[model samples]
Target chain A: MSAPMDKPESSRRQFFNGTVRGAFLFLLGAATTLLFRRSQPKRTVWQIDPYKCICCTNCATKCVMHPSAVKCVQVYPMCGYCKLCTGYFEPEPISLDTGAENQLCPTGAIKRRQLEDPYYEYNIDEPLCIGCAKCVKGCVLFGNGSFFLQVRHDRCVNCDECAIAIACPSQAFQRVPADKPYLFKNREHQA
Target chain B: MRRMLRACLYLTLLSLPLVAAFGVERFPPPEFDAGYKMPVTTMPPARALWLSYVDVAVLVAALALASYLVLKKRSRDGVLALSVFSLLYFGFYQQGCVCSIGSVQDVALALFNSGYVVPLTTVAFFLLPLLFTLFFGRTFCSGVCPMGAMQDLVLLKPVKVPAWLEHALGTLPFVYLGAGILFAATGSLFIICEYDPFVALYRRTGSFGMLALGAAFLIVGIFVGRPYCRFLCPYGALLSLVSRFSKWGVTLSPTDCIHCQICDTACPYGAIADPMLKDPHPDPRKRARRRLALLALTALLVVLGGWLGERLSVPFSNSHATVSLAEQIAAEDAGKIKEPTDASKAFRQTGQPVEELYAEAHRVRGRFAVGSVLFGAFVGLVFGLTLISVSEPHERNVYDPDPADCVSCGRCYVYCPKEIVRVKRIQGKNVIPLTPVRGEQKG
Candidate 1:
């Protein structure tokens, strides 16, 4: 009788241990969830910048993904929409050629259509525009602020917070109203 | 008790509108724009150096102390050390605003996404757990977790669960782990960040329901034990698997475990495996069967979750995609609301685009719903599967003894049935054990 009693007692202890382990786990999750829920002002998880951008030719090179999400943008109102835009190609072309080779953009993103016999129209094909910003640099340096780089929020994932904001070299990125996100600045650069 | 807390937590959450009702009449509601950015941001070399030194020193010592205390014989001193270390860890986890698993998941997912990369501080957070876990058992859930601390304090008594429920719930965390990775990988969601309930508990301004939930959990934890860890957390689920396969961990002594449930009763976190009558080896066939069963279960959960997340995300997903607005409107001579609502509403600076505003609103709701469901499913699975799987833990001498998954929670170490203690050695540096010092009681 005593020997059999020992066996029952051992199993009972084992049973208790198993149950405790289970309950411990259940509470761990509950506790973690509750604790993490403590008050926090909404945290902005993502951000981006625009100022320190050099319009380097490397957006095409640095990106690991195909068709780099980065693309060149133009402020149409600020654009001269030049008929003979130097930003599109060399200022003095030997001949007015629209051939891919002669075109200023390596990716053929720039489409120089004839707006008029004298004033040709230049537009960007964003699908091909690699934010290399070569055109932006050219336009900004010589012409009106027609060409610039702006992030297409539509293409951005915008995590609960923004990651780009932390990585941006320039401090140009600002948190616009979430309801009406982009606070586009068509106005000239301020000193 | 748990039911009461849940009611409170939910009620509190439901009262968010009330809180908002009292919000200031500013243009951009403070809720929308005013918040601390992830502190892991802005970290550079000097800050890194200081943080690393402090973090390493503190974590190592804590880890050692926790292990020593947990494995020591049940003395008054040992118990006190155990409680303090565990609470301190919980406090630290609360202050940091993110746990190791969540932090790691965030950083890893960020790195995997081509769209962006998490800050280097995220890297530090992710790695800390693994380093400590190498020497100690899951210290994160036991000691360094604010959530654990809360439960530890509240559990006046513990309850017993049936083995069947434990088994069913045991599988949820893994499902959560796999799902979290997949969703995070696909850039569909950062699930970990969206649904952390404890963050609400710490701030004390959480919805009353959540506060009640917190309170309930604390009370229930005493009777039932580490319910949160065992049942609800996807991250904990991940750690359990990692620890299961660990090469080293807490183990039993080579003596008779005098058939006493004292450790079982005393363990606030409930991580003890009785030394006596435990099988040295788990039935291989049973384990294989469970593994196979889990694979099928995980597949079903991930697919269902992914589809549900996508369906829920449809409205916000399209509008939120980044496109250069300035360029799109380059030809416009004047600007007007793309979508119409009064621009006078909170945060809608006079000329803001209504479409963006609507999109943002949808974004928050969509994420909340998706996150809540996924997290809910995860919680359900952890508890259900664990209950079902509950068994006389095999007399395996050691627990998961690996660098990953342990989180150095120190439970395995402290509750180890072992009589022989491993005295850890650190050279040229004073390492803080993940465990607490037994004698020092802090007010």
Candidate 2:
């Protein structure tokens, strides 16, 4: 306790022990390499964020792999198809045929569900939806901002770097504070 | 074999002049001419680089490498080695989520905003991947892109794209490609930008629709890696054709495979087309029916894609195009505030009336929906054909080379065991790099 340099272990023994430690480090490195020949690091990614989305549909169109990186998910309770659906078509549709020739959604994503004889509900086909937001633009510009876009975190890499973020024109994309990231629609914004 | 090699050499030599002279370059207008009269379609500069030299070099390199790797006759590791590297380049570097070809679609669509197509780069970008896709499977998806790369990286586990769904969804991208191109050609519209998910996601900064779409894909990719490429990438569909005849691809070592599912676990991409399906494509009557159906579908789509392209095109360029009253107000306000810059005036002088161009906003809405359905139908047809006529799946355990998507990232070379052998090439030996690994070592 009195002498800091003094120890039960001898200096020669300590040096040899250090050499052995170095040898172990080398072995550990080699062994680890062989064991993990095909191993890669795992990263935590997200499903998406709802806030900050301006309802552009790049998800549907931009995905390189096909089908796309984007898919439309439903928040069914929020849908209300006014005669003028900003997310569905231009403010004034020529006719209400529900034909592809009339609607705003590129992939026939916004399916019109009849709630009653007059009141119809618009629904998005998550599979077919590319999130290009032709409908959203139409909706926001003319009718209620019911339909919006989101960054599905699940599909996102949460990359230490994000590719889409760099290319975003609106600078709408942002990193969610890692703890709790899903920014759903605000109560007032829903209207 | 020697003759083929010589022919390749000759092709490379022949293409050199074309590349140097034609590679994408901005040439000054004719010295004597003060006129704005320019060629409607100048030779796409990049085409020279791509068609002549780079493509030739890539093809030669890929073929030679494939032969050498095949001769290794070692573990399924060989396939994984190359596959992983290609996946990195295509998926990561290229930001696989955004389709460059589709950007042409977007650029074409920006007619509403008076964006003339940014030529040379646009055409070359669109066509290069397509050209590659014809012979190689959508290898662009596996390695040389970012969307697929993101999925590949994010995937904790991978599954195969379901047969029916895969077949149906797969046809969509081609329809998109064809229609997108057609619309661009017609100078009518580009719906690609109109429906860009990433752009929207980026613009709005946050999203519900885009998030949902991204989430769904992530989930799908987790279950089935490269879900977009196998079932949805329009470019992938195009590239699949090119990759079909690819000289070398990720093939398993038949003898070494031992039906040990380890490689299956190791290979993130569900590319190991089960040998059961890999049996040589079969049957005459069924095949004939398929051929007939394909021809019919192709005809239907070509007409449909063309008509849709035309219809879509009219919205931005047609003088009689519909414009919403609100848009008219916005546009009028914009025109007033804009003060007709010299560039815009010049732009107007080169082409049609500015007001006429502005009047087509109404058509933008219709083009998207119609374009989607038509494109979806086409995708369905393509996938249906693939499902029915499945053969030469990644039965062998080595990676296949795809020019369309390959960015030439060397991740797989590093991971490959035999890459350590240092295979020789006449020019010089390509040394394989080491693989990158995550945090604490497992051992």
Candidate 3:
């Protein structure tokens, strides 16, 4: 069979394609420049504003990663080092001791060591902490609010939209600079 | 045991609480006689900023390589190899965060919300594939998109879907795209990222429902080829639109068409377009009349669809958290619900005015009303165009790849006898007798 020739139509199609392609290229270029101009110079990562956080414990369950990246961090300067630390002990504890049952932390993450007479240092076992924020509630309400939840950079996969942030009722999540990922109670007080 | 002891010792050494005494100190820290050094609170460094630039570089390289493999080499093996690498790097290693598929929301949010700034990496991820597709049809889908790669690898037994069903299901991605953009624009939610099916599989940790959804897609993919790519991927929908005007794309045969009909069955996506012979007798008047009628119908559909979408605004706006919170608070006040939900209780604790919450929700609802109408009109336009295109007669006289649907997988190359002959000639092997064309006598 002889090849069907449509030279005029072919030329018209080529011109149309060229025009459309050029328009699309221009549109893409404009969009890219606009977005680039609006983009922040410093990359930001997900963080929890300690003051806004109501310690609802959603961080434990709502994180995409099991065990959650939101770990309870202790701001040492702000801590009172009270012997009867509310963050380490449950309400109406049987005894003011480091017993698993008396500890407010679900995973026994809080380790209480005697620093001196009537002063006990509470350290968080980062691996054992499940980010429940149960202790945060106790600390914020009953004692110095030294204990606060922070998204640990090492563990966080840093999802574009944090699952915990969506679930937070208080709208506590904020995008902090990557270099200063943690939002500490002490630092906020200092500022 | 020694490691545990060391850790405990390290914890003690790091636990020196200095009495800066900034906050309300209910209980004062005990003073120590010995000079005890205060250890600063340590923070793990964030993922290096430079690494994100590396991801962009890798993405650019992959897109370039994919276009070369699909067009220049026309090697299926090369495409498969590249796709596997994409699956490992983009899917598992990166854990599927900030992907092009999910970046749609970021771009939308950036455009609509001035407060929200999209990262540079995300913008690169969002725009690169479209730029590549505009020049060389959907090479991103062929080998670079991790989601497509995952589905492609799982496709073992390909089942051909009926044309009508395929066309019906094909509208889903457009709807999904519309909703995703709407939600993102309103700053309500990133539904696209929230419901991503493969992210859980990539991370190996997510909600049970997401895992189940991913599993279902994979199981369905075993029989169907790239189910998500064809029917659900919003990014794929965008790419297809751009691919229609691609400058260069995969070709079935190296030389002129010999009408072998082998490549017809070779493409799992059914992207091959068969030759169409011109009718011996034509009626130009009837064709013109039908086209005009269809155009009128399309215009009518756009109006009707927009009206229907306005009616749906109330239901769609409920998906926004603020609107739902307001409704919940209102319900509790009306004695519809005896107990307040956690969210409502939290709102009450904030001591914010109830009227303010309602006002915010009303604003959100108003935005949704406008957004939904536009979304519906777009959907209507796409459906009407599809109908018109389906009714039009094909004018092609040669077997070719459907530009919009062909993903440049390069699978059809091996099916062409002419391609095999070319390969053999390059290998310096004995030439086989050329197959005679149908209805033409061989010498």
DockQ numbers for every candidate?
Answer: 0.02, 0.01, 0.38
Candidate 1's iRMSD: 21.7
Give the 10-residue window scoring lowest on summed lDDT in candidate 2 chain A: A1-10
TM-score of each: 0.45, 0.38, 0.87
In candidate 3, what are the lDDT values of residues A1-191, reduced to their tens digit?
Answer: 11122223377787888888889999999999989987977988999988777788899999988779889998787777777677888876898888888989999998888875656778888999989999987776655778889999988988776778877887889888898888777634633
Per-residue lDDT tens digits for candidate 2, residues A9-121, read 34775566456445544643553343233221221223334433444455554443245544444343343434334456544568776877778776787787644333456
Q: Which candidate is the best by lDDT?
A: 3
User: Stretches of candidate 1 above 4 Å error?
Assistant: A1-191, B1-57, B71-94, B178-191, B206-213, B258-443
Quick one: best TM-score, which candidate? 3
Clashes of each: 143, 105, 0
Report, to 2 decimal places, the DockQ of model 1. 0.02
Can you write out model 1's per-residue Cα lDDT over B353-377, one digit (the tens) per residue? 7577455555545554565456445
Per-residue error (Å), model 1, residue B219: 3.6
Question: Candidate 2, which CAPRI tier?
Answer: incorrect
Segments in model 3 whose C-alpha atoms lie over 4 Å from true places: A1-9, A81-84, A94-101, A113-119, A187-191, B1-24, B32-40, B276-293, B331-338, B341-355, B426-430, B433-443
lDDT of 3 by residue, B1-443 (tens): 53354335434533545222122454444466666555466699889999999999999999999998888777899999999999999999988876999899989989987888889999999999999999999999989999999988898888887778788888889889998998888877888888889989998988898899999999999988889888899998998888888787776552467877767666778778766667432788888888899999888888878988898989989988899999999999999999877688779877899999999999999999999899888888878888887778777766778888888888777666666666677679867525532222211
| Top of the candidates by DockQ | 3
> On a 0 to 100 scale, what is the lDDT of residue B175 in model 1?
61
